[model samples]
Target: MAIKTWELDSNFKNEIAAMPGGEGIMKCFQCSTCTVGCPITELEPSYNPRKIIQMSLLGMKKEVLESEEIWLCAVCQTCSERCPQDVRISDLMGAIRRIAEKEAEEGKIELKGVRAIFEKAFMHQLEKFGRMYEIGLSMEYYKKAHGGFFAGMMAMQKDYQKLGMRFFKKGKMGPKSMFPDKIKRTGEVKKIFEKVGE
Candidate 1:
């Protein structure tokens, strides 16, 4: 579909550049270095960092914000390491995601995938325990992903039954794993979350 003229927001790039890790966005010069080095691009041809940057520079605000391509970046930083202009493409992707998330939260747009859900679940576990709690993380992920506790449990069982059994046999997961003691510095962890307004 062709983009309408009014859909463009000339200030969009500047808005992103103002965000942390986004300051280098304008340094990009359409060099394909980032795209060339992007592991995701090799696996998924539709995920083009160079194209995303060019769109952003061209003020394709809505397209860039709502595109699933932004979420495909794995943040492995190969692109950042290879960028001759030091665009920090991995960090740039993160800045874009942050904006997308903000827009989603404000009801301005809908996110199309489970990545945001999984991220919230993961962060909730981290914030609560000051470290990862796999059982809790799994439960939370399924609950949000599938919509409820019972449904999540059923889905989890169907998906992980064999793996769960193996983990149990290897003492990797069990009843005791369900209620791990929170880390000693959990308060410190909460403070960090507070500082970030998470």
Candidate 2:
């Protein structure tokens, strides 16, 4: 068995350090507090904040940016909360996500499905009733992603079924429940993203 080595660029660290909240990645001392604090790790074995920081520190940009683990993060803030160095690990992950998106647009990366799912799911909510309608968004997301089998199966869970029927019966599709005023900000958010690229 042989271990393959990735050609890490020397400038990668400097580039990542320039992103917002990225400076703390360099200060991490491998205390493992972050890994212990992350609830996602309990569910998803691949979701390790410590390894992510290590990769970032080593300038493994390709691995860090292309990982589904980054997007799967629940943004629970526990990693930062438990850090002995007070590093903002969650924000660092967010910076990596932004960089990944930029890399994707430039043809340097190909994480299209991740962006597509997120955008379509988000836009469906924005266009329909303003903020997220859990049932509607999940249904639309599944229809587009998995052809509804997975979503349908998940919806069959007792709690999910109860919630789904309640929402369906209540028909919570209005201004008060979904925040109609927030609908106008969708374009603004899009424009902000546009400027971020420019």
In TM-score terms, which candidate is top? 1
Model 2 alpha-carbon drift over 4 Å, by segment = 1-6, 112-116, 119-164, 171-198
Question: What TM-scores do the predictions have?
Answer: 0.93, 0.69
Candidate 2 lDDT over 1-198, as tens digits, reads 122355675566677679987778778998899888678998887888898887777767787788888787677898888798987888887777878878887989766344456555766665655566665666566666655666655644533667756775788544455433456557765665457532
Residue 103 of candidate 1: its Cα lDDT? 92
lDDT of 2: 0.71
lDDT of 1 at 184: 89
By TM-score, how accurate is candidate 2?
0.69
Estimate the overall C-alpha local distance difference test score of candidate 1. Answer: 0.89
Off by over 4 Å in 1: none
lDDT of 1 at 176: 78
